[model samples]
Target: MLAGFAADLVVALHFAFILFVVAGGLLALRWPRLAWVHLPLVAWGAGIELIGWVCPLTPLENVLRRAAGQAGYAGGFIDHYLTPLIYPPGLTREHQLALGLFVTIVNVVIYGMIALRRCRLRQRSRGEVARS
Candidate 1:
């Protein structure tokens, strides 16, 4: 029972960390502080994903599940969970790179828009100061 609970916690954290990486990028649009960590993680994640690499954690999780006598999934979490939602068939190397690119592109657009809006706000503030 204790081991089962521990395994559950590990799985939960694994899933939550995935969310933290993705949603965290979106949240960074509001809080610049996360950039210190999120920026590098985003780049690393995209690169790994684009290269069709498996993270070490996945194997570790599989090993644990096997010890627990559970059926371990073959691919990464994205393959088992996300692929069904996004694609009709299996996720290949191309699919991983595509997902990485999509994430980077979307985050870039979000950051760009946020920066542009901030610049406009600053410009307006300067103009008001000059007028005063």
Candidate 2:
């Protein structure tokens, strides 16, 4: 039972990590310092998808489940849980690549907008200083 509970906690943490990977750039826009933390996560998340690397969490969770006398699952979290809800079919390599591409595109757009806004603010502040 204790192992099962630990496995559940791992699952929750894994899901939260996925959410952070997907949308954490938005948070970084509000807190620029967070980029140092978020960028590495983005890279790891995208690499996992693009390179087809299994997350270590998968095996850890599986071991926990097995220790609890439950049958360990065979694949990553997305393959077991998310695929059913989102894809209704098996997750293929192309789909994984697409997910990586999607993450890259989203962060690019978010950071691009942040850069544009900062540039405009700098220009506006300079104009005000000149007028003063």
Estimated TM-score for each candidate: 0.73, 0.84
Give candidate 2 regions above 4 Å deviation.
Answer: 72-89
lDDT of 2 by residue, 19-115 (tens): 8888998998899788888889999999998999988887888898899887844355643785344333588999899999999889889889888
Stretches > 4 Å off in candidate 1: 1-4, 73-89
lDDT of 1 at 101: 91
* Candidate 1 per-residue C-alpha lDDT over 29-58 given as tens digits, one digit per residue, 9 for 90 to 100: 778787678877777777778877776656
Q: How much lDDT does each candidate structure score?
A: 0.67, 0.81
Best by lDDT: 2
**Distance from true position, residue 129, model 2, in Å?**
2.1
lDDT (Cα, 0-100) at 81 in candidate 2: 84
Q: What TM-score does candidate 2 reach?
A: 0.84
